[model samples]
Target: MLFSFEFSPIAVATLTFLLAGFVKGVIGLGLPTVAMGLLSTVMAPAQAASLLIVPSFVTNVWQLATGPRFGALARRLWPMMAGVVVGTLAGTGFMQGSHAGQAAIALGVALMAYAVLGLTAMRFAVPPRAERWLGPVIGAVTGLMTAATGVFVIPAVPYLGALGLPKDELIQALGLSFTVSTVALAAALAGGGSFETGTAGASALALAPALIGMSVGGWMRGRVSERMFRRCFFLGLLALGAHLASRALI
Candidate 1:
């Protein structure tokens, strides 16, 4: 059976990926974030999550490998990665079956919070000494957030942003974190029987448009003002979040 909402699922997925990919191409992040925010409107968050896995994972891996100090970054972030996995697995029960609506609500709240933070341009400074203990905790919380929502950029993104890494390092760190989150989410879904062969195939099919969008976005990077684009992106997220939250409630 075809997955149909008001529109054809294939059309929705293709257009969503194209736009989400474009956004990511223009910015360094947001493929999963954008995709989840949009796709969740037409389908359950769990279903949206399954469709996003392949594109998110592949894009994040590409992002993770692009910059330097890969080994050092991985070593530094392993604890947090482990924490993410643990938290995600622990929280996976809340995302399946009858709890999906609650998960959608959680996703909405997370998106709203992220949008507010981005719009405010708030910055935090985490002392280097604090990272050893804080990273895992942050990871755990982020993982929980991921399990509850299909999105994973809550405190994790903010915390990483606070670390004060250089530009390249920061982007790499995001890729690393997102990559782990993707793998963990996939595992949790598979364990719960949400990510089967059909979902995997759909996810794989979504990858092409995503890549195409990314290519266009990358090309547009030089021409577009990042600050302007980010502002627009956050605004879109804010509206989308509101709609999802309200829709879930009603």
Candidate 2:
């Protein structure tokens, strides 16, 4: 049977990658964050995740590698990374059944959480001692949340942002975290037999649009104040999340 989904799966996937890529180019993150969130509006979480696997992994790897401190960050953040891996695998199990409504709701929750954090302008720092204990816990939650919703920001992004790392260090750290979660999510989905040849092929093709969009967004980045764009982005997320949440609940 053909892989059935809403909104012309290819059309949805293509636009999603393009838009998500542009956002990443502009903001330096959100390939999966934007892809999964918007795609979830029209497809199941599992399929959205599968579509996400390739583009997210490749870009984030680039994001991590170019940062000049992967080794140090890896050494420092290993516990959280490990926890993300484990948590992603565990939560991905729920996706094995691939419940669309549940997946939609989970995505909605993740989107809302991200938007709320982004809009609030609330920022704080975790003391180093507390990070030792809190990092892994936060990672686990982020992993589980990503697995369920296909949106990996939520507490993870907020928590990481709160850690008071220098600007470059924070970017690398996020890339590291996103890389781990993407790999783990891929593993879980593959293990569950979610990818057929057609779906996998389409996912591979999505990288094209994603990369193109990223390039455009990248070009626009230095030309604009991302602060205003980010606010608009989160507001959009808030609206999309509310729509999804309502779909799930009502």
Candidate 3:
């Protein structure tokens, strides 16, 4: 694994990761949504996903492991985790062909639509009985996207947020979701022969800036109002989605 001391790409990747962390720290979700969208503009979608795995894992682990509500989050989110695992496996295997760029674009557009609907104040009610299916459905989406593009978790977060859980619990749930999906994705990539030793090393090097960004963002989380953070986060997502859509179309 040769570490390219070429500072330019590293610098850009670091900055992007930091910004993504800032958004996640503020809004309780969206590290992959932001990071992958931006990184994909410069790096290949698979490369962007690989670069982000370590940082996302580290930061989410910090959030989940340190939180008092970890146990409750685990209990509540097991179904979603299972779904994420399944979806990730499916995505990694079937979605990893050379034609995946088109799929990434499609996924990005779908995410944009979801963001737009949220901006429009869309509403839906899950029947008490149907709620049992939510986790698996979301997990499946997250996993597939994690393997194919890395922004698939956006559709699930809003529904999870609407559940009206405590803030800490929500963060822990997000952490758990990210962690589980990332692990599954790593396994899938290995199984599919998509894991590259050089890329993984580069990704590890890029993790430093992402960690720095997470620290800064976590600090800001304490200072900013949740409403303001959420507003900014969604707006960022809108911009990211639009950018990706255009990239896909061009």
Candidate 4:
């Protein structure tokens, strides 16, 4: 597909990435949700996912390198990376033959479900034994969805949240997870006959706006209460979910 941007779509996409990144910066999550939801309105889910790859990589690199708890991050990295690789392979395989619209709808529903779960007052703990296994499961699922849709990270976030990890640790984990998944996804795309030069250029073009958003959102993280941030995030997910679901059904 030709990706030459007329001014209007470029402006909209730029704003969307900015907002998505801002949310991610503050909360240490939600960038894919924000970007995929908004971008899907204008671009195919595959296209949107591709656009996010570079920016997510850049931000996560910064977060993992400079964020606190590098030691813990190092310890957990291997298992999570394994999950990301496995998941990406699965998702990429699925996407190679699947319909993009179907993938978008599925991703949308997953995001909405996650948002609803977050909004719930009920909280539960995962046993340590369970967590070891659960990490890969979530990672695989995230990778698959990420390969299929732009918003694959949703499945892992709540699980991490429920682990009662410190805020900084959770952020680090997410950055690491995204990095691994994106790499795997990129490899899959290269092999799947879907990765094209034009698409990659478009993705690179979109990265700047996404980075801008992340910067803004990171700044807002300190200003908001946890409760407020969670609430806003939930609402955004719900809205995005509704839009994707609607698109699929229509």
lDDT of each: 0.89, 0.84, 0.71, 0.74
Clashes of each: 0, 0, 4, 8
TM-scores for all candidates: the values are 0.97, 0.94, 0.85, 0.88
Tell me how far the alpha carbon of residue 53 in candidate 4 is from the true structure, in angstroms, after superposition: 0.8
Span of ten consecutive residues with least summed lDDT in model 3: 1-10
Cand. 1 TM to true fold: 0.97
Best candidate, TM-score-wise? 1
Tens-place lDDT digits, model 3, residues 45-161: 666777776777777787778667877677777888888888888776543566556756855775676667657666555555665787688778777767776665755666666
Candidate 3 global CA lDDT score: 0.71
* Predicted model with the maximum lDDT: 1
Measured over all alpha carbons after superposition, the RMSD of each candidate to the real structure, in angstroms, is: 1.4, 1.7, 2.7, 2.3
lDDT, candidate 4, at 146: 74
Off by over 4 Å in 1: 1-7
TM-score pick, better of 2 and 3: 2
Candidate 2 local lDDT, residue 14:
90
Q: 1-250, model 1: which lDDT tens digit per residue?
A: 2233455766888999999999989988899889998888778788899899999999999999997888998898888888898989888866778998998888888889999999999999999898899999999999999888978898899998998889999999999999999999999988888888888988999999999999999999999899999999999999999988898999
Q: Give a tens-digit lDDT track for model 4, residues 78-106.
A: 67568878878766644445587687787
Deviation (Å) of 143 in candidate 2:
0.9
Better of 1 and 2 by TM-score: 1
Q: Model 4: how far is 93 from its true place, Å?
A: 5.2
In candidate 1, which residue pairs get closer than 3 Å at backbone N, Cα or C atoms, i.e. clash?
Answer: none
Candidate 4 deviant stretches above 4 angstroms? 93-98
